[model samples]
Target: MTAPRLLVLQPSQSDPLAKLGEWLEAEGVELHLVPLKEEPAPASLDGYQGVICLGGEMGALDDLEHPWLADARRLLSSAVSQSLPTLAICLGAQLLAVATGGQVRRGPQGPEVGVLLVAKRDAAGMDPLFADLPFTPDVLQFHSDEVHVLPPSAEHLAASPKYPNQAFRVGSSAYGLQFHIETTPEIVLNWAAKDPESAACARPTDFDLDFLAEAHRDFEEVWQPFVARFAKLVRGELSPAGCLGTQLPLV
Candidate 1:
């Protein structure tokens, strides 16, 4: 049999999708990293077993600024129509929300950054995408906007203190998480140092390279198995043990 194809929609120079590509490559899956910013076409998503949408600096509402946004939304809508397995992170999640008739707007108060706890919503137990995660997981977050409302057919999965719609599942297989489960220490530091202005605005004074490195180490162990479980779900191997409860730190 052929390898399971995973299509990644990448739109930023940051290349955060590389982290997920590395993980999926190790699992012997066929990976395709497509930069939608350059070539935005709905046909690009064809023949992929699963789709992952990576975060970018762009806002979902700014379709005029980024013409690719419209194409990406069309692709996501088609993916939903087919019930294809999909995982969206950060800005990608916002895009998914907007494409599926949800609202993506600036937070009522401010941005949510650093590591924060996300409480699983009522339908989380039945969500195959969230398999192996705790009802309350301390996940990495960095976003100024969030999904305020979900589509009529979507099921809420997880929420953070700052953002109630942190995670949602649409049409069973398509998942969107506002936090960054694909982040590593290197990736976080690279973006932080490169974007000094945004960093200054979102990061607290105590949020230094050292802090990010330490958090990366602590979260990596928890995130690895989580990704593994998600990959398994994409491959259609959903078992009972795969239904992950809330993951708290091991003492």
Candidate 2:
């Protein structure tokens, strides 16, 4: 049998999937990194079992200035049409949104910076990937724009009270997360301090790198298994768990 392979599209020099990549590696999933900003999008998704696009500092619609975005969106659109397992993180999700007949714009609520709790929607119970997560999983949010209109085919999965489109799954294998599931403490600290807009959105004092580290550990305990499940889905070793109801977290 062929080993499970996923395409990782890196859109920025700054943001990368630090922890998520590590967890996926431990699952025996092979990763193929594409520096999409500097190079061209792959001509085809032929041999890859799955695809993942990480966040960037830019908006999803800035295709002209960042012409590569057009290709990135096209790649995501093609992946969904092919029904390949895909995980679009942060800006990637936004790109996926616009690619799949959805809309994204400057969040009316402003940038949702910092770690926040996102509750699983009732529909999430039936989702293969999200069903096992906590009622309110801790997700890292550092985006300025939000997914405004999800494609008609998309099913809402997890959501934050403030941001209703925190997560969604389209087709059988395509997933979109408005929050960042993979980020290091240094990344968040840099975002909080260096980004003039993100820094202005909230109280910088609350950034608290030490506290963010603790929060990230909370994220790992919940999301690492989640990433493992995705790898299994890609390998076809496990079937979608489907709806199992709200699982009680181990004490």
Candidate 3:
């Protein structure tokens, strides 16, 4: 059988897939990356079993600055409409929200940065992507925008005190995460160095190389398996029965 193929749309130079790409590839999924700043996004999901849109510094509505964002939003909307396995992180999540009849804007509470925890909502207990995660999962938060209102069809999956729409599912297989599960220690350090103002929202220890590395270790322990399950969903080896309050044997 052919390996499941995933189309990964990278919106900026700063937010490369890093560990998330490694984990997905390790799970035997073929990834095709399109750096949106440098390349045009494809018109549709064509040929890809799954799609992922990575975070970026740009706001979700910044089409004037990054024209490709329009195409990215269209692709995300397409993925959700088709119930294709989809994952959107941070800015990508904001885009997903807007593409699907939700809202995104500057975070009123302030920027949320650092390694943080988001509690899974009761609805997450039956979600194919979120059901098995710890009630409070460790994630890297580095965004100034928030998805305050979910799409009308979305199922709320997780929340933090500051951002209520931390994680959600737009369809049976399309998921959006308001935090990062894809960074490496070095990538986070670079982000901190580039945006000191946003970085200030985090604890001082968050930038420490050792602390960041250790946090990544903990992050992988929880999210690597999560990515594997996503890959399974893409490959048709896993079912979305959990969405209906049932479990199907893995193929």
lDDT values of the candidates?
A: 0.76, 0.86, 0.91
For candidate 2, which ten residues in a row score worst on lDDT?
Answer: 238-247
lDDT of 3 by residue, 130-209 (tens): 88999999999999999988998688999999989999988788889999999999999999999999999999999999
lDDT score at residue 39, model 2, on the 0-100 scale: 79
Of candidates 2 and 1, the better by TM-score = 2
- By lDDT, is 2 or 3 better? 3
Model 1 CA lDDT for position 183:
78
- Tens digits of lDDT, candidate 1, 1-251: 67788878887867566556767777767877778777655575668877888898889878788888887777787777776778888988999999999998888867677767799887777665564577677777777888989876788888876779998877757788898877776677676677655456554742566877777666666666767766776677754222334668999
**Cα-based RMSD of the predictions, in order?**
6.0, 5.2, 3.7
lDDT of 2 at 157: 89
Candidate 3 error regions (>4 Å): 241-251
Measured on C-alpha atoms, candidate 1 has an lDDT of: 0.76
Q: Please provide the root mean square deviation of candidate 3 (C-alpha atoms, Å).
A: 3.7
Where model 2 places Cα greater than 4 Å from the true spot, the runs are 203-205, 240-251
List model 2 lDDT by residue over 56-104, tens digit each. Answer: 9899998778989988899899998888889999999999989999999
* Clash total of candidate 2: 1
